[model samples]
Structures are given as structure tokens and as C-alpha cells.
Target: DLNQHIDNEKCTKIRKQIRLKRTKIKKYKKQINDYSQRKHKYEVQKSILKDRNSYSKTDHDATFMRMKEDHMKNGQLKPGYNLQIATNSQFVLFYNVYQNPTDTRTMIPFLNTIQETYGHLPEYIVADAGYGSEANYMAIIDNFNRTPLITYGMFIKDKTKKYKSDIFNTQNW
Candidate 1:
């Protein structure tokens, strides 16, 4: 047989080469599996963080926002919720936890939630300049049929002496 004719040294050399190739193949398979697992983990994290700028790894639902007290004082964003609370007299009327950090986009939704949940609407709603905008005023007047006592963005600036004394000011005209 041809197998019987092969030299022992040549046969052993061939077996060693085959073993080396097998080890390389196994390593490649393991690397491919590792890559696949990493890709799957990234996809899952992305799904959890939909539409958010950043999310806390410790708390998946928590979004990163600037806190009122920044211990670091470097404007470092920490994971937290934007809490909107409405109070009448001394008691709490309605409160909401929002994912977005800005208060600008929250006023309308806060009013809508109160109306839907409690089946009531107040005649006059008071809010700060941060919640003031033309769109918010229109929604309050038209959609909610309520009066908004919200200060416009330039309300404070308009009260300045320079602005009040200027004859060329639009309000003066």
C-alpha cells in the first residue's frame, strides 16, 4: 500500500502540520464568536437608549441631566429625571417625571396630563419665563381654553433701565 511506503519522519511531520492548522482554525472560530457576542450586546444597549442623548449604565431608564447642585461644579451631567410639580395653596396638585432636561417642552404636556387625568382645567395658569413661548401661549388659549400668565423670554431684559429709557425701543413705539 502507498501508506506503508511513506517514511516515518515524513508521516510525523505531516501529522504535526495538520495539528497546527487545526489549532489555528479553532482560534479563528473563537474570535468570530467573541465578535458576534460584542455586536449583540451593543445592539441591546442601543435599543434601551432610544432617542436619548445619554443614559446611565447603572440605571437604564435614567437620562443624563444637569443637577441643581453640581458637586463637581464643572457642569458635569448626572443621571436624573426632570421633575415637574404643580402646587395649589400648600398641597401638591400634579407632578410628572420627564426624560428631557429642558423645561421649555414640558409645559404643554404638563397641562394636558392634568386635564386628562383629573378631568379639570384651571382658568389661569402661572409659569415662569422658561415655560413661555408663542406656541405655548397659543396652545393655552386655543387648545386648553385657559389664560397663561407666563413671562416671555425677554421679560426681565425689557425691565432694564437701558431698555425702558430707549426711545427707539419697539415697546415705546
Candidate 2:
């Protein structure tokens, strides 16, 4: 009877440990799989964000930008693409989508896309002040035989009375 009591109480401690380990493995099996899935998702996101400052989580190609349509008053930036579209007399001419927020950097690429897609550029490349820059102007002058009627960023300020009165102002000349 004493030998039977020993076998029941303390003779198989290793077997007890084995049973506990098996229970733990069964309980945490789903947790280990969840952790593995999360790690894979993180790796995918890192690859998608390579060589970019920021990319939208929902739309990997879109960048964070301030949209005019934000319903909130906080002026919060959201995922968006800069669309450069040209129109004349209410007719669409050319359009391009850019990840950059500023229009200045999109001008040359937009022009190139226009030429590539249409096989010809308009005589006058007209754009707003935002698309105006010395680099853009030089590209238009050197690469294409087109005229850039784009105004610079200071177009409004240059037209002011204070600007016109300045002797150093080139517009005064």
C-alpha cells in the first residue's frame, strides 16, 4: 500500500512536467500564430516604405498632404495624390498624378508626360504661379521649343505699388 501511494504522489514528477508543457503548448498555439502573422505584416510595410519619407497605410502609393476637402477644422493632413491637370476653355488637355506635394517639382515631369502621351506639346505651356520656377522655365526653353507663360511665386507681390517703386526690382526696368 505504501509503494502504491509513492507511485501515485511523487514517483512521476517528470511525467507531470510533460503534461504541463503540453497544456501550455495547446493553449498558446493560436497566440504564436498571431505573433507570426503580425511580424510578416510589419515586414511587408517596411518594404513598401523603402526610399520614401512617408506612405499612406491604406494606400501605399499615396502621400500625406493637406486636402482642401478636410471636413474637420484642424487642417489635418491626409492621404492624397497631387494631380496636375491642364485645361483650356473648359476642355481638359493633359493631366498627371504625382506623389510630391508641391507643384513646382511636378511641372517638368508633367510636361514630359504630356509630350510622351500626346506626342506633341502646345505652343504655350501655361501654368499657375505654383508651377513657376527657374528650373521649369529653363526646361521649357532648352528641351522643348515651347514658351512658358507661367508666372513666378512673387507675381502678385511684384505687381504691388511697393514692389514697382523699388529701384532694384527687375519689373521696374
lDDT of each: 0.86, 0.85
Which residue runs of candidate 1 sit more than 4 Å off their true CA positions? 1-34, 163-173
CA RMSD (A), model 1: 5.7
Q: Compute the lDDT for candidate 1.
A: 0.86
**TM per prediction:** 0.72, 0.65
Off by over 4 Å in 2: 1-46, 70-73, 164-173
Q: Write the per-residue lDDT of candidate 2 for residues 4-60, one digit (tens) a residue.
A: 444566537765766666677777997899999999998898898776667998999
Poorest stretch of ten by lDDT in candidate 2? 2-11
